[model samples]
Target: MTSRRPLSFWIKWLLLIALVLGIALGVTRALGKRKATSEAARATAESLQKTPTYTLSSTDVVTVQSIELTQTVALSGSVDALQTAAIKARTAGEIQGLSKREGDPVKAGEVVARIDSTEAQARVRQTARQAESAQAQVAIAKRTFDNNQALVRQGFISSTALDTATANLSSAEATHQAALAALDIARKSLADTTLRSPLTGQISARLVQNGERVAIDTRVFDVVDLTGFELEAAIAPADAVAVKVGQTARLTVEGLSEPVQATVARINPSVQAASRSVLVYLRVPALPGMRQGLFAQGHIVIGGVTALAVPVSAVRNDKPQPYVQVVREGAVVHVPLQPGATGLKGTEPMRAVEGLPAGTQLLRAQAGLIREGTAVRLSAPATVSN
Candidate 1:
């Protein structure tokens, strides 16, 4: 520092110091930028790690339980009267004094219609007069026969004459017997003009009108007993075996607001050839507004038993075999089930399932988004109401 240097030497020394300082400053700035970039990258990575993953919520979960399940078989049919009778004209004549029409209520032995009885009554009277004349002749014949017997014994007349008188008396008695029989026939024919109902029911149809000529065996009316109603349903052979006499049924008619109760009365012994189904007859009580020919559907209770049951909606059949979605350890598990007897769950339908422990949670409805091993959040467990 004390020695004086040349001007060029001094300049060169100052330039070298400037270059060294510039390099040091540039290196410091670069290091600072690198440190900031690394810190920002670390912060972003930590934020991503702290965030939670998305999951699905399961709402239709049902807990499997041991309950009393009533098995049922579904059936359909038309409502029909237990008794239907067709009224026919018994005698051939013009319809007269017609008293009943369609929808008219009738009682047993009530006169429904009357035919013209002018000819019938005249025939009866004529036959009766003839019978009276024949009876007088028979009385005269008896007296003549008695007198002839006394004459033959007293020899007042020849035996041959007595025999001729006996023959005449016999002939007169035969004529009298024939006239009486003819009178009886005419009286019965006259009474046949009046048509009476054999049963107490309502007239369903009136085939003949007043003053219309009809022949014997003509269908004059159709009567149906509405007090006792029955449903005749056809059941498939597979289900027919389960149905039995005395089983209760619930019927739903198109016009009725509530289901009608009925009991299984009988079953046809032979299967129908065309439908390959068995016919089941069910007895129904007379309701306020039930009529004939109303279509109805029903279910017969086959039996009642305790079983591990689930709602029919809960069971799925997407796979080759039927399966159910179960929630286990907060994950969806697909369980294959061996389904058993199908039944009702208090008006709702249910099916019996095996190979699952009681109290296992199952899905009430199928979820398209849920699959095996998928994590789920469970809501409240479903409970069946009585």
Candidate 2:
């Protein structure tokens, strides 16, 4: 009624109204699409919730069986001669000759090497002559004492003179004894010049050569008794408490094809400062071709205990808490477990688990896929090997 004259103005108003109506229709269509999508998703979820689970057969399960779990402590060590002798020169002398060389088999009391015994021999002879002179002096003193005694009884000499003679005889006897002891010492020094092996073994090294002058306590040879071997194994202090004398171990040497058996000979009381381990000495069986200084590794079986366990394949660890799937009364049950040790069972890996009783049926393979309340058929379960 105010200004209906301009047709352009009327067209503009009509356009504006059409644009608003279009926007409203678009928004309504968008809302309808969103509602339809939400309804479809809800329907799909309900259908999935109502779907029946598939049943797994007993063949797909592993029965948790009673197993003998042998606990072992790992050990590493080196091979050594059971008895080793470090030969040294007791007396200083020139190495005139060596009777044995490296790898030479020696016997107890054997002369392995000889020093320059010429000086020693000369000293021994001189000592012997002195000893002989001392003996002569003692004999003469004894004669003088006897003569003085007879003279004193016959009144030929005074009592004081007799006493003087006795005193002289005692002095002579003491001097003779001193000379004899000196001679004995000289003889010992002479014997020491000839180096002798205290034990029967093979010479592992020769430190001195002929014509070489050596001082006292100088190393001459290294002899090792190859008849038997020893293993010095270092074990953790915690496990070493269980180790005792006479406990046996199976050892593997570097070159040996089969494991050698050894008996625990000794155990160190104090822990090693650097390694924080205890030293355990084991005596290895003396077999052919066994040598010293070879590296070895072994295990000490502590004891065996019965435990309910399953193969390692049955345990699933993908979740925050490790668990295993078990089939009970025709339904799958999710069981969270406290797993103990792995690699306890022979060749095949097995796991020690708690919170599960014996005869529990666990899935044989891929237990992670199992869900709670899933249906399962009770068929004959597969036996867990060990």
Candidate 3:
């Protein structure tokens, strides 16, 4: 603390210089560390930019080809009867016995049942008696007319009496003829007691049992023609237009392995008043064990037509319209396409795209992440498969 001012000037200057040098050294080290770090970061960035593109493995790219497809129109309905007939008695009589029962098969004119006709027989006998009385009157009048003619010729009878006898004889003859015709008609009607079938079919019902009092024109039985069953169903106007007579179809039944084959038979042009649907009739191809009124599902083929198709996966819906992932220079690009028809039901590749050209190669695997241009590897070597 004593008299230091003059002596401290030189020392102060040297200390100041040392402090400046130390500060400069620290600054220089920091700058060097920062520069090294900056260079390292730049090199890493450049390396990353030069890396290979992200792509799928060769086993991941699945490819399927486009094929010809056809559009299908479908409608549904159930089975029915082709013809139904109710057998009725033509003459009134007691139902004596039945020759055929329900479910029994019979041909046209075959006896189904019989009836007691005791009253019909009695009516025939009464008609015959009337005919015999009229014939006796005609004979008596004819003999008297002949004797009157002989007496007139011998001058013993009047012309007016002969004429009266002749008129009576003619009237009696006409009455006798009318009575005989009535008797014949009554006997013929009595023969109708043997009830017969009007068609070759199975008996569906029996309205009269044996000993039942049946009246004329009474329904005796119900029969259904089962040779070929009719399937009746209603379809929309749009669907009916596609259906024409004789178009082949397939019938699907629950729990049935094989579908029944059939053809379109009739189409009722008049729309239903309530449902506004056209009635359609389909005839199943005859097969044994087929029964009328059996519930069944019907499908009409209409017909098949060929059109371009593609793998459904190839079709991308990401955009407002449909498109596909097209590869370009190891990047992604989207290509737009129009979709068209489909193939047979199961035959249509599930999730398969339709309407592409037949030769078009499409992506069939995971469609996501597939860009327009990306490295692509086929599950099977595409070059070899082609």
Please give the TM-score that candidate 1 achieves against the real structure: 0.74
Write the residue-wise lDDT of candidate 1 on 171-287 in tens digits: 999999999999999999998998888899999999989989999999898999999999999999999998889999998987999999999999999999999999999998889
The C-alpha TM-scores of every prediction are 0.74, 0.73, 0.59
Model 1 / residue 25 / CA error / Å = 35
lDDT string, candidate 3, 1-386, tens digits: 68656767989999999999999999999999999999999999998677556555443333334333434445566565677788888788788768677899989888888778787889899999998998998899889888988988898878988898889888989998999999998888887877888889999888878888888889999988888677787888888888889887778754456788888889997999999999888887546666666677756766555444444545677789887664444455666776555445333332334443334444544647564555544344431011
Model 1 pairs whose backbones collide: none
Backbone clash count for every predicted candidate, in the order shown: 0, 0, 13
* Clash-forming residue pairs, model 2: none
lDDT of 2 by residue, 327-347 (tens): 778778888888486435654
Stretches of candidate 1 exceeding 4 Å from the true structure? 1-59, 158-167, 236-244, 267-278, 317-320, 329-334, 366-375, 384-386
lDDT (C-alpha) at residue 274 in model 3: 98
- Candidate 2: lDDT over CA atoms? 0.82
Question: Which is the winner by lDDT between candidate 1 and candidate 3?
Answer: 1
Each model's C-alpha lDDT? 0.86, 0.82, 0.71
Candidate order (lDDT)? 1, 2, 3
Worst 10 residues of 1 by lDDT: 51-60
